[model samples]
Target: SELHEKVKLHYNNFKGDPKDVKEMKERIEIEDE
Candidate 1:
């Protein structure tokens, strides 16, 4: 339950923080390359 709730909380935060989401996406892309 804690893991599920944490995931939900993070999802909401990601929506609220566009800059964070963008940076996370960029980091993901960089790691992929």
Candidate 2:
């Protein structure tokens, strides 16, 4: 759960730029596979 919290924190920290957030989500999806 720590990793999930960290990811959430990181996502929240980057909540300003939509482009970067979208890219981050895409990268996370790729890494999931």
Query: How many residue pairs clash in each candidate at the backbone level?
Result: 0, 0
TM-score of predicted structure 2: 0.57
lDDT of 1 at 25: 62
Q: Tens digits of per-residue lDDT for model 2 on 1-33?
A: 567667757877885679989988787666555
True-vs-predicted CA distance for residue 19, candidate 1, Å: 0.2
The positional error of residue 25 in candidate 1, measured at the CA in angstroms, is 0.2
Candidate 2 Cα errors over 4 Å, as ranges: 1-5
What lDDT score is found at residue 30 in candidate 1? 62
Candidate 1, overall lDDT? Answer: 0.61
Model 1 segments more than 4 A misplaced = 1-14
Per-model TM against the reference: 0.52, 0.57
